[model samples]
Target: MKPVAILYDDIFLKHDLGPGHPECPARLQAITESLNDLRQDERYIWVDPPEASPDDIARVHSPQYVDWIRQNCEAGGSVYPALEGNLVPETYPAALKAAGAVIQACDKVWDGEWGGAFALVRPPGHHAVKSSAMGFCVFNNIAVAAQWLVDKKKAASVLIVDFDVHHGNGTQDAFYSDGKVAYFSTHQWPHYPGTGSKREDGEGNGIGANLNVPLRAGDGDDEILSAFNDRLKPWTEERKPEFLLISAGFDAHEDDPLSEIRVTTDGYRQMANVLKEIADDHCMGRWVITLEGGYNMKALGDSSRAFLEGIVG
Candidate 1:
């Protein structure tokens, strides 16, 4: 399988949160450098993430929110993850492209050009809501992409797996009542933006479509892998999703300071391999992932390489 296209653009380099913030611009540089250092293989198709139009973003976001972000793009100030109330105004075009990169990734993955794709864009996007921006995110990238596949691509089933240390509340909120997409997440409960509870299965027709596996703080690879076997795999296999999207976050790594989940670098590879196998079996090998969080530079670089290696296979 050809490595899923990675929508890359240097413009994502300028999304500065502020001095010494954990979610710094340097993270992307590390990922890019590591990817470049690897030998060229048949699996990769590098493509610049073209800007996503306002209409594309509107698929999952409120129009007013999109316009507000455009107005605030260059409005720079204090950085977030706020120890104090520091308001850092998001730069306009940077947020647009970051969200856009994922949009393009959605298009590519749905078209079946590559087996799947990963968007290494930043100001990582899992935390942003439909009308509010928080947690260093300006747009809900994965949610928008999921909607595109359902609305534009005419997909009847979509599966989204979020492995971020923090619950993907934004993504959940977007699809809370919709059964067209399946949302599964494994995250640290009682963490930041605190939402994903084991009881949040879904509502109405989407009742069982949303699955939450709230891992305790400090759970390591064995625990996560068990959760995958006991929960995600069985559920996803039965659902037989037509398209799959991943909210790939490396913050669970032991080296990362953000949360207490202790997933190692090797665990990341194992999980990627498993996820890829699932996609191949169910979705005709159509899976797309977008970066969410991984603060420690070394951890992000290592984990990203492992993920790419699995994708290229």
Candidate 2:
């Protein structure tokens, strides 16, 4: 197996939410610090990506929303009321880079240059919608990457597996009507954003394509992993996606202040391993993952590193 490609840049650290913000720059710093050994090792390759163009973002976001963010940042605005995120002056460029980093991860994995790739980005994107930003998310990074693949004809179908503690309402909204992209998520129910019910599956042509397995707050490894084995695995086998993507978030860790889920370090690895199996079996091992929400710095670093280990193994 080839080494996993890591997409990162210092610019990601510049997307400061604000002082004492939970989604502050320290999250990335913690991840970087924890993964320092792996980064230096020959098994992992780190790549700095270019800023995503407005055209790139337009693939998934509405033109009007994109313009709003740009203008908002240029005018020295610091807070985005829609998402409740502090949008500093440098946030505009940082968000662009974040989207671009995920795109580059997809490009590398699609090209078979790496078995898998992870975009350790800030301003976590799973909560951002097509026309609005929410929950500390600016632009929906994973959505843009998947849509880009569809637009370029690089993939006929894509599978998005979001294992975040909170539901990826934004990613689901992006592909709700498109059968070409199957959105599957396992999130805490009755949580933030108040979405992700199993009944809220995709509409129109995508009715059966979206799968949401909403777990309870205290659901841990046994409960969460069983959901994957019983539902996600069989569903992926039926769909046989051409590519795989993950909205990887570690906020479910027991120590995280955001949620009450009790997933351990090993639990993250187990989930990643299952997803890796699905990718290997159906997608020729083409996988791209992007960071989302994970507030507990120590747990975030440990769990994310474990996820990488599961992927590379």
Candidate 3:
């Protein structure tokens, strides 16, 4: 098997939103640079992401929302960041390509053409709703990719896991009513956008399909590990999903300016290892992770490199 597929380009890093934005252009630069510096792995292949067509997006989003995004992108100016149910301009295409990369990685992994893949693109998609962009996301990339795997590829049940410091409300929203997918999230509760409450279980036939593990402000490695072993792992073992999609974000690192979770770069390694084993045992070693958040440059770079190293392991 070749090393993980990396979907990235300098252009993907060039969509700037000016200074003081936590979601800076340098975040993408940090990921690309970290991937370039890895010496232990030589099998990683880098590829530029193409724009996902409207049909590809319609799998999880409404055609009207898709049309709105195109209009915003065409109008072009600093638009309000998309989150949950609203999409601003300027963030449209960026979100689209970010979602495209995850879909591309999914196609690769499901085809058995690769062991795994990492989508290093950004303007992270976890907060974006199917019909609206939220939390700086215009499209729910991870959710869309999972939907395609379930509907088009006929996956028995796809597991979507998000470890971003912020909860993946948008990803959860897409699958909350669909029983064919499971959404598991570990995020700081009472944080930004603030929607991953434990009581927000799945709706209708999707009851028990959604699981939210909200970490306290100071919770760190030990607590995360406890949650994984005591709750996440046991539940996942019974579900035995055919594929796993990770919303990989390193903002939980102690040094990040983002919300406090006190996790270290090593925390990412540990989490990646756990997911890798789960995927291997229950999902034929298939997994695709996409970037979410990690504002501090050093933490972002270090944790990302650590994650790729674990993938290679």
Top-lDDT candidate index: 2
> What is the alpha-carbon lDDT for the whole of candidate 3?
0.81
lDDT of 2: 0.89
Model 1: residue 7 alpha-carbon error in angstroms: 1.7
- List residue ranges in candidate 2 displaced over 4 A: none
Candidate 1 weakest lDDT stretch, 10 residues: 78-87
| Candidate 3 deviant stretches above 4 angstroms | 81-91
What's each prediction's TM-score? 0.93, 0.98, 0.93
Question: Positional deviation of 5 in candidate 1, in angstroms?
Answer: 1.4
lDDT of 3 by residue, 1-313 (tens): 5567788755456555555678778887887777775434567777787767778888888999888778766776444544322333545667678778888899889988877888887677788776776776767788888987887788889999888889988888888988889999888988987899999889998999899999999999998877777888998988889998898888889999878899988988888888888888899999998988889998999899888777557
**Candidate 3: residue 72 Cα off by (Å):** 2.0
Residues 173-230 of candidate 2: C-alpha lDDT, one tens digit per residue? 9999999999999889999989999998888989889999999988899999998999
State the lDDT of candidate 1 residue by residue for 1-313, as single tens digits.
5555777787777767666778787899889988884437556778888777888888888999787666554465443342222334535566677778877887777787666788988767777888877787777888888888888889999999999999998898888889989899989888987899999989987889999998898799998888777899999878889887899999999999999999998888888888888888888888888999999999999998887776556
lDDT of 2 at 135: 89
Cα misplacement distance, residue 99 of candidate 2 (Å): 0.5
Model 2, C-alpha of 282: deviation from truth (Å): 0.5
Per-candidate count of clashing residue pairs (backbone under 3 Å): 4, 1, 7
TM-score, cand. 3 vs. native: 0.93
